[model samples]
Target chain A: MTSIRRRQVIAGLAMAPFISRYPLASKILGRLVIIGGGFAGATLARFAKALEPRLGVTLIEARSRYTACPMSNLVLAGERELNQQTFDYKALAEAGVQVIQDYAVDVDGAQQRVILQGGERVEYDRLVLAPGVQLNFDQLSGYSRQGAQDMPHAWQAGAQTTLLRRQLQAMPDDGLAIISVPPAPYRCPPGPYERASLMASYFKQAKPKARILILDSNDRFSKQALFQQGWQDLYGDTIRWQSASNDGRVNRVEPASMRVHTDFDTYQPDVANIIPPQQAGDIAHRAGVTDSSGWCPVESVSFESNRQPNIHVIGDAAIAAPMPKSAFAANAQAKVCAIALVRLFRGIRPEPTVLANTCYSYLKPGHAISIAGAYRTDNGEFSAIAAASGASPIDATQALRQQEAAHAADWFSAIIQETFG
Target chain B: MGRYHAILPMLVLGLTPCGYAQGAPSALSQSASQAAVCSGCHGKLSGVAVPALVSDARVLEQQMLALRQEGGDSAMHRLIHAYDETQIRGIAEALASQKNPPAAQSTGP
Candidate 1:
């Protein structure tokens, strides 16, 4: 064969696994069970079936509908609705996946069974936990589950988001609103900033005299420059950001008086959105996969729990830094995990892996910024390839912002379909 | 005794035949799995101008190779740099070969 033809032949073989069709055998392989029907687990359940039709994939989710946190800020701003962000599992059920509505109380790695809250045990050949994040309410001095009802964190969407919205709407003109951001290694690094922008957007029109004070635990945040610039140009003195060095971190909260106290000062605001510290969800700990950091340690390539065999962890629950815990990251990790599980069931060792993340933060309606990159794992350590990642330029035109905003919306739809459908 | 007879009962004990049928482990394609990751960003934008990968293999290859050649300290470059020419070609072909439903595009942000 000619040299060019030889290279082509080699390339074809390398690509064959991706393109080749497996025989449609209606036979059993093994039972694959997934906990949490969010971005990672749902996508894994869907893709596993696509890869191997006979793989018995069962997804256990406590909630009937998923409200995407990616664009839930829009819902908070009234630009979108909760119903719009919410999605049901009918599509997944139609695809032969057994969707169970129950909380996974415990995961027994030895027996490979997930014990539901109602005392039923479901068996699995492979168990995947994509339980996302659980808020560390104890991290803050006076913050508790009940305290959240009064001073909404609104981080996980649903009721808290609506309560914060109502509070913002009820605030009188010239009222001060406080937003407290937690330190790093949190879900969606840019999320609190996005919420601040949307709240500012609503207040700008509704109560022009209202002001927002952002108390950040970190010295810096994602897209800080772009977000700061947008605040300056658009909101104009309505939003003020304090870095951690300046006592920007909130040390305590007085929910009764609606006051948040920082290291340097205290602010009595009409509305407060306090995003507390976060860790892996409950099931990861129950599965005995979480490490000292309260996050699951996984082999980067397959996302299999480092502490437990036959169980994989993905999304915010996994310790995949350099890669932020965004919905997009979860979706990408799910695909990799699904394929790895499929390969393992067939007794084939999974290959080295590549993953990707594209996080878009809307600074305001019809304007946004994004950071995108690809990741690879070597010897179980994950690293982002800087050459393949980038952020939108700081000095972007309005037209460009509009285009990016459009892209952000399109991405949201795509991801929902990819995960749910 | 036959060699297969020794493990027969173990197979019945271990494998649940009512669920997913077990078969000899076959290697899954790395390119296909990686391409599935791309749909997170590039696929399903109905009216948005994302470079489509599902329609053609050569287009996907050209864009990926171009990004790889246009070397900079960018994230996309670093991502592609991790893969060899063979892997890139495989990914492009895998994306092209997928016959899944076209992602429903969104008209709003």
Candidate 2:
């Protein structure tokens, strides 16, 4: 940790020449306000301050504590606890970021101020919205916030995670649990499948007769081949996955009866996890940054909102195609945005950047698979570098899978430290 | 020393010359920003399986270039293929120049 601090100091010192190049930058005392203290916003706030201490960075988060979504599936499977997934903004605040525990109700783009739910107006020289994704319950018929209490989506990873876990615990030995997956462009593309895998593993011990059914709205998922191989090798017939083309798109939910309706049939499962389709958080829409697709469009390099000037969007809120909305992707995007913002403040063009993402999914305890890709800005959009992108081989040995699982755990620990520790 | 060594000359020829000249201060700064991406996984505080990214520039560069040429489906191999020799060298130097505390322990998984 001392070395990390020393490296941060060196990074700060290395920026001296760039600041000296623009005389005004040395005296610039700009305010950078970021909304949502999740992976992207918190990382951006810390990195921006580390890069330029003079920049007054403020992070506005609604929740006093953040519940991470990355490894929350393990919580549902009784492999991990919810507290392990929860983090606070103390470290970020200690790093000189003004952590505001208040909800941002609206953004006055013209006035360059954010109106909080507590009826306070905070001004900013540059604003960033990293509000992650808002679960669009309306997109799924008969599913509302109230309905989610009965059939927990568990997507946001706190109370809902506990709710789902309790439901699984209460289920009978031979009961069936259904995981309804939304379409693509949602946060954590491979998440629901991992949930199924872990739940199957849990049931293999606790309720060996129980089964899992994945009703996916997409035809395919991230790391599909490897996940299928793992499912076959480990879980056998314990888990069943249905794609959208096979009438797997969940259209409605009868939460009172715990039934999920698909085009061909209705599943009256003992437990239901309905992950709803999503869009940018409400603040992005209020800020007029989101397009008709319900996600904010941004320039690939700086993540500046295409709709509004001086307001950047990162993480799941931004339409960074070819970059899945994983925690690692969000972290990488936040750093790139921080670097771009620092250079922009000094009147230097943001350098061309290479963004990378690696997502690991546990198939069972001590077994996992992964997918990795590197992306670059090509013709004003984010494009994957084909030569550098692939998933784990289907024929990987058990030892390799165990090693990947270890890497997965290490990755979660490392990213948690990078974001909050 | 086969196809991996054969691709070295082409990779060198395709290098971006301006920001990556050896020992250039600007190169360090630029690569520092780029290397921030690595912190998401390869943090300073090493993990049980993932090693802390504290190594000499030459060693780091050689490891990355070799991973790129090995052409496997492993995460490191896939990610390492993203950079050319110059960018890899810059990132290597930037990470190598960081001061590692004397007590920092090195362990293998």
Candidate 3:
């Protein structure tokens, strides 16, 4: 669940322990069903399996392979192949998750049965939905689903990465590459910024005269200082950003002319990447999961949908702000969810939850910066745990940024090992 | 009754709003700082996979002790093992008073 701009990051964990079957072992709990076998879904399934070998685990994945949103930008930038970002469900299925290669169309969470698009229903004692995100193409005129064919979103990963890469390569040496970034409350808030930097990584060498323009709807963005410094040092004059201050906010766009409409005027380009406003997937809406703000509000601690009692929603779809929607946050959240679910299995009361998130993004090369925070439930709403949980300092030196990058890679490996194979 | 006995020290902790200590704030003693450090790693406090401390003094103490000993030579020993018995109790007590909030309320079903 990722967009070219806001990539979806999910984390899941499963813990399974075998029972010697002392008579009443047959009376154990019902099955657990997880939807959207991305990071969150897959990690939970594995963790749940680790927790209880006999506890049935079912995973509904629309596709067989997972193209991670975390590093997909590397693919689009031609730094890495799609396979590098690609993951197969074989490892997850090998872990005892009853993997289904089909779309989960409806979740009767109240009844704990997930209904597929093909009229198949899978029952569960507990349900987890991490369907990732659905793009809001409607925000920009003329960029329909078909329009994405010529201009790939590459938001969801896999072939889209290839398509976007090809488009970039096909652009003339001094051509224009305009990518519009949607406003806040989107997944991987710093993603569009990272994509810009990574794009510059390629364009700098191949199309030295080509320019990479980011048309941001908002004035402020995640890791702002770091991005600015990176663009200044790395791209020099080749990369540009138009924030709300410059009246550079994109209001709409016409697909035919590859033209984008900002507050003042219109501009056409050789290539366009329009990441429109985003909302939770339609399935979440159909299941009565969202609030008036077009996002899900849960118990703030359990991430249990305020709209539904039994179903839990994690990942970018949930409004777990004060903690931005990032892979680290989702991973933190899925673990909490896994813990609570385990306690529920034994009929134990769940304690209050405290969550933390640290997101790192590099401008380019060895430079990296981060924002870190801790969150806990306060008065039924998730708020920062305390300001004591500080943000990373600005303009860190090369060695420090390099260390952060090293840690970033370690974190990814440790997290992937903990969540998935 | 045992839970109460373990929690009774809090009435005597006299941990003021801020630093009661010299190096660290009296409010955040060595024990408190250590607790903060511990949470830096294991403090996800997620209600699902991890339990929220949530007004449970006895449970928090037991959980802390169990987790501390669960991993022999754990990387978290700096916080978990740095404090004495009373200090450990203080950290667990503080965490207990805290409530559990979902990471995200997830309005969407």
Chain A TM-score compared with the true chain A, each model in order: 0.92, 0.93, 0.89
CAPRI-wise, candidate 1 is incorrect
Query: In angstroms, how far off is B91's CA in candidate 1?
Result: 1.6
Ranking of candidates on lDDT, top first: 2, 1, 3
TM-score of decoy 2:
0.87
TM-score, candidate number 1? 0.85
True contacts kept of each: 0.47, 0.43, 0.00
Error at A224, model 3, angstroms = 0.7
Give per-residue lDDT, candidate 3, residue A30. 48
Candidate 1, residues A284-331, lDDT tens digits: the string is: 999999999999999988888889999999999999988889988998
Name model 3 segments beyond 4 Å from true: A1-27, B1-109
Listed in order, each prediction's TM-score against the native is 0.85, 0.87, 0.74
**What DockQ, on C-alphas, does every prediction get?**
0.20, 0.29, 0.04
Candidate 1, residue A232: the lDDT equals 92
User: lDDT of each structure?
Assistant: 0.75, 0.77, 0.62
Candidate 2 vs candidate 3, lDDT winner? 2
Query: Residue by residue across A1-421, what tens digits does model 2's lDDT show?
Result: 1111222334666543211111235455677989988889988888787667778788888777888998888888898889988888887878778777778899989988888764566778789999989999999999999999999999998899999999999999999999999998899933998999999999999999999999999999888888888788888999999999999999999999888999989889999999999999999999999999999999998899999999999999999989999888988888888888888877788877788899999998778889899998646799999988998888888887876787677567656666785
Candidate 3 per-residue C-alpha lDDT over A61-173 given as tens digits, one digit per residue, 9 for 90 to 100: 77767677766676767766777666667656776667777777887766667776655566777777777678888877777777776656667776767888898999999
